[model samples]
Target: MRKIPNNGNLKMTKVAYPMGLFVCLFIYIAYIKWHWASATQAFFSITEAAAGARRGQQAQGPLGTTAHGHKVFYGIMFDAGSTGTRVHVFQFTWQPGETPTLTHETFKALQPGLSAYADDVEKSTPGIQELLDVAKQDIPFDFWKATPLVLKATAGLRLLPGEKAQNLLQKVKEVFKASPFLVGDDCVSIMNGTDEGISAWITVNFLIGSLKTAGSSSVGMLDLGGGSTQITFLPRVQGTLQTSPPGYLTSLQIFNRTYKLYSYSYLGLGLMSARLAILGGVEGKPAEDGKELVSPCLSPSFKGEWEHAEITYRISGQKAAVNLHQLCASRVSEILQNKVHRTEEVKDVDFYAFSYYYDLAANVGFIDAEKGGSLVVGDFEIAAKYVCRTVENQPQSNPFMCMDLTYISLLLQNFGFPENKVLKLTRKIDSVETSWALGAIFHYIDSLNRQKSWAT
Candidate 1:
């Protein structure tokens, strides 16, 4: 190597040093590329997850777990009715690709209704906030932001003037916005008469497990609220759909099924409203010169004060020799004449009547107050005649018993329910109240999910 080194050895050494350097450079570059790619993938994954959360694509995990490892959720619905405002806090659970299960329901009610504050919209805030507190107490802290909160006004706000109703709703929206729960632009609204009927229909069918299966025998819903009465049934006969009056047939979509139902809400035909009408008093208006309202439905010896729609009136029975049921029936017939559209299809459908129907039936021993029962349309008539005779001979505790029974009996007949037609009366089904609140909330959640899907 010292003198005249071999030419092949020198050449080999020179090439080997550069080749080694090039190999080291390639390895370093490859290491850097691998780390950068991994970091970029991680960043995108986090970004996508955050975006999904923002879109209400909630994480599926054990955070709010139930039996079968189902994820739990909640919905808060405020039913602003003519008589009162009720809050329904519902805890629901569901697994992937399944219908939600109603695990628990917490309900609270406050009196005098939101419409009581129509003149003073600000006064409605306290009651709404109180109900919201009930929801907060029932639902977990983690679900506050995830839960859907809504308030639906029924006939109470529907009867109000447009401007007044809007003001009250706006006040409610303000309170909802300040709360931690999820709120939307359409959170507070007055449900139209048809929608009210459809919602109750949904509630009854859903609670009975009919909505879970296709082609299941579905029952009709009859809800007699204070200010309105609803009759809703799924029509199986083509004659019903073709013969139904305009505004009576409505389409309801739920759980991926479309239903064309025979539904109608008769305003001013509810128990309370009918009482006012039968007594010859105008709604939302005081009697002229503070006069008294006399009706044959009351006892001739009875004289008292009756308050309706925040107005008190002196009411008395007419000094007539006619039968109480006879006179009251005639008067109720007058009120109902041409007011309701009769349907023969109702005769064949199984019906569940609630609200005032349940209250009246329970009051008269027709059904158990807690458990509820069934009654024939004729049962109401018989109860009416019996109660009428009793009221005629004695001072009754409930002065309107005779009148209410007669109205209900005649109301059913008018709706084409024969005397033998059986109706199941209940205030609750499966420990949950049989009201429009549950159904309305379900529909709302469904719509929200649909909207989110569309956006994505």
Candidate 2:
């Protein structure tokens, strides 16, 4: 027989079972919430720490100080050229009592040079500020105050009227003053042709490791820009110093040493300017009555337009079945005669040609386009003849090739470089640009350091 269960005891057992299950479920949920909250806190902490570290690193400087406690500095150089405006942000490492080493360089270029805004000075601000922004991006914010900012106007502004050039420079100075970089009264000046030559000499010599030691022979510099061409070398012979015409020699003091350099810049003799002169077009002047410029340097069948200094002109080749090279050479001679001062000293110096010299040679396969190569002075003449012949046949190819090649050949001869004289042509050396910008910045920094020492 089944015995009757105790009613009170059964009721108590049912109630306690549900209560115990509820308690266990509540504890499990609490544990999960605690774990999640802790994990989230840890994740946020890690993120904040990483951001703080990055901020600290930036404050220290880009690339920071060297192992020897030497400081790393920066310089911003704006090359206001005839063709374009270029900014070079140079990272340099300096040790006490040693020449600064260019660790790296950042460069960018914009077309329509500073002189393009001669009539409207305010319009040039945007391009100038754009290039400065590039420098801001490449350089760390901490170093901006110490870095020197300079813009050296080349033939572009040199060709401008004195008052107009000053206005352009004053505008640049105003922009520079508003920036974070160091600016001086002389910061934005038209670099004279002589100074331009000397600076280029410094750049080439420093890059080739010639400036590190005393009494080492320095290579000569041949720079052909858009509006002018410069030839500079340290004269070894006493006769060179004595015979050099007035205004052809300049004495430069750099790194506590003086260099009496034979440097000359031929104004209106640059490739582009020469092109205008060759085409019978006057600078800063449009063709008379919009007349077309006809020359034998171009193929007889070619007709086109050429622009220089913001002036455009219609150009065509003369219809003549003549020796193109000879005719072109005759015209180039007429432009260069009595203009270029010939010196025998250029023959003995190991010379390096740059700018249009390199460009023209590379165009005709006379040298490697990228790596650059050596060629004899006569190579230009030979290439000119070949290109002229090819132009006569092709006619539609590079119309200016015949003219440019012929001009370079004759120009080299005018400088006293013989047919067999070898010239090393390159756009860069040791991965650094062969330009006056670097040397200009170097000199400017050196001057600042000297001034600081004197003040102390």
| Per-model C-alpha RMSD | 6.8, 15.0
Candidate 2 has its poorest 10 consecutive residues by lDDT at: 54-63
Off by over 4 Å in 2: 1-69
Q: How would you encode candidate 2's per-residue C-alpha lDDT over 159-181 as one tens digit per residue?
A: 99899999999998999999998
**Residue-wise C-alpha lDDT for candidate 1, range 1-456, written one tens digit per residue:** 578779899999999999999999999999999999987656445433542332223333212443355666788999999989999999887675766789899999999899899899898888899999999888766567778899999988888889999999999999999999989899889998888888889888989999987899999999998999999999999999999988888888878788999999988888888899999999989999999999989887789999888889999988863688898899899999999888888889999999888988998898999999999999999999998888866656899899999999999999999999999998888888999889999889878877776999
Every candidate's lDDT:
0.86, 0.87
Q: Pick the candidate with the highest TM-score.
A: 1
Per-prediction TM-score, please?
Answer: 0.86, 0.84
Q: Give the clashing residue pairs of candidate 2, or none.
A: none
Q: Which pairs clash in model 1?
A: none
* Candidate 2 CA-lDDT value: 0.87
Worst 10 residues of 1 by lDDT: 54-63
